[model samples]
Target: MNKKLRKWFRGLTAGKAVHFLLALLWFGLTLFPLYFTVVSSLKLDNEIWDTMFQLPSIPQWENYFKAAETAGILSAIVNSVVISLGSVAIMIVCVMMSSYVIARRLIKRAKALNLYLLAALMIPLQGAIVPIVQMVGAVGGKNNFFVLMLIYVGLNISISSFILVGYIGGISREIDEAAAIDGCNLFQTIFRIIFPISMPGVATAAIVGFLNVYNELPIANVILTKTENRTISVALLAFQGDYQTSLSLIFASIVIVIIPILIFYLLCQEKVEHGLASGAIKG
Candidate 1:
């Protein structure tokens, strides 16, 4: 029995060691592109192709400034920030209120309404792009940032609501009753009591919404035709030409765009992880 137990323990240890090595390998693979982008961005365009891994003998810091100027990156960054933040803020408020009402069964047709909202998630945005574009044109909403914000909010509402619903369902009704007893109205109770408690769900929804709006290219490209109104994703196209492209400048632009997102993620990493985990378990 002792000999058999020793052999089993050895096998388990070996298995864990193999898994550890695989995880490291996967991590390296995942990080290689980002590492390459940083290194390549600093090298001259001519040297990029030749020296894939070598450090640049002379770092071209001006590549970033040149890329920014050529692409109107500052304006693009502003547009992206405004649109993403506005959409996320609006989405969170609307979704939280809708989810709260639905989860609490506050209305006569709550079940039906919940089902209808969830159904929206199944519909692909690509299928409705034509109609959306036509509607935007009819209202002169093309190239308008506010219109873009509305579009993003509408697109994200259903999924955000669904996630919030699952999380809201886990909250006890006693909290609502207690808040009411303290002379709080429905809106006040929800905002003061429930909203604070549901930060995990809110954070989860916000992160998802922000990413969706920030990285979305198809809709932004169609809606924002004007150069000044373009987001970073759309503005990146300015670096490409029909015959020749500035490879270093393009890489530098990529790095600049990536920095804000990376910083945001790092700052909110703990909250994001916690929010996702809590939402998954409770939702």
Candidate 2:
């Protein structure tokens, strides 16, 4: 038995070592481009090509600053931040309130409401974009922030509310009864009790919505006509159109466009992971 155990332990150690090496190689493959981008962003054009494989003598922090100027990077960043946050904020409000009402409110049409949201999940964004744009334009939403916010919120509602509602459903009914006994009305209970309890769902909605809103280009490119108002994703197009091209500057700006999203993911990855895990367990 001792000899058998020793053999098994040796085999497990060898397997683990092979697995570790494979994982490290894969990780390096994924990370090298990101490392290259960061390094490329910091180097002079000459340094980039001449010493392409070499690290910078001293880091060039000015690439982001220069790119920021040439690409109107600051203004584009502001527009992105505002739109991303605004969209997420609006999504959270509608999704939470709607999900809470459908879950906790004593409405007779609960089944119908659930069915409606599920149906919404099946509807393609591409199918709705034409009518949605026309409707918004008709409503004087051309170049309007409020209208854009409404559009983002509405488009996101199906997924966000579906997740929220599912989690709300999983929550203990006794919790609701206890809150009611403590003099909480539906509104009070939802805001004070349910939202806090279902925080994982809220975080899930936020991270997903933030990512989508940050990178979305089609609608922003089509409707956000004002150059000053264009989001980073759209603004990146201006660096090189067909008529004129600057490959280096364009890649430099592409590097700039990636930073904020990278920062957001790095900062919120822990929360996002936690939210997903907690929600999965609750669900």
In model 1, the runs with Cα more than 4 Å from the true position are: 1-12, 108-124
Tell me the tens digit of each residue's lDDT in model 2 across 1-283: 9999889777777779799899999999999887777677677766777876678787777666666777687898788889889999988977887887776656879778878987987997788889988897888777777777778877778777767876787788899899999999878888898889888778888988888888887777777889888888887887677786544465678777787778878988887776666555654
In angstroms, give how far residue 63 of model 1 lies from its true place.
0.8
Instruction: Give Cα distance to truth, residue 105, candidate 1, Å.
Output: 2.6
Kindly report which residue stretches of model 2 are placed more than 4 angstroms away from their true locations once superposed: 1-26, 42-62, 102-112, 115-124
Can you give the TM-score per candidate against the true fold?
Answer: 0.89, 0.80
Error of 2 at 111 (Å): 4.9
Supply the global lDDT for candidate 2.
0.79
Q: Give the per-residue lDDT digits (tens) of candidate 1, residues 1-283.
A: 9999889777777779799899999999999999999999999999998999998999999999999999988889889999999999988888888889998999989989889988998998898799889999999999998999999999998878777888888899999999999999989988899999989888888988998899888889999999889999999999889999999999999999989989998998887787777666775
Which candidate number maximizes TM-score?
1
Q: Could you tell me the lDDT of residue 11 within candidate 2?
A: 78
- Scanning candidate 1 in windows of ten residues, the lowest lDDT window is 274-283
Q: How well does candidate 1 match the true structure in TM-score terms?
A: 0.89
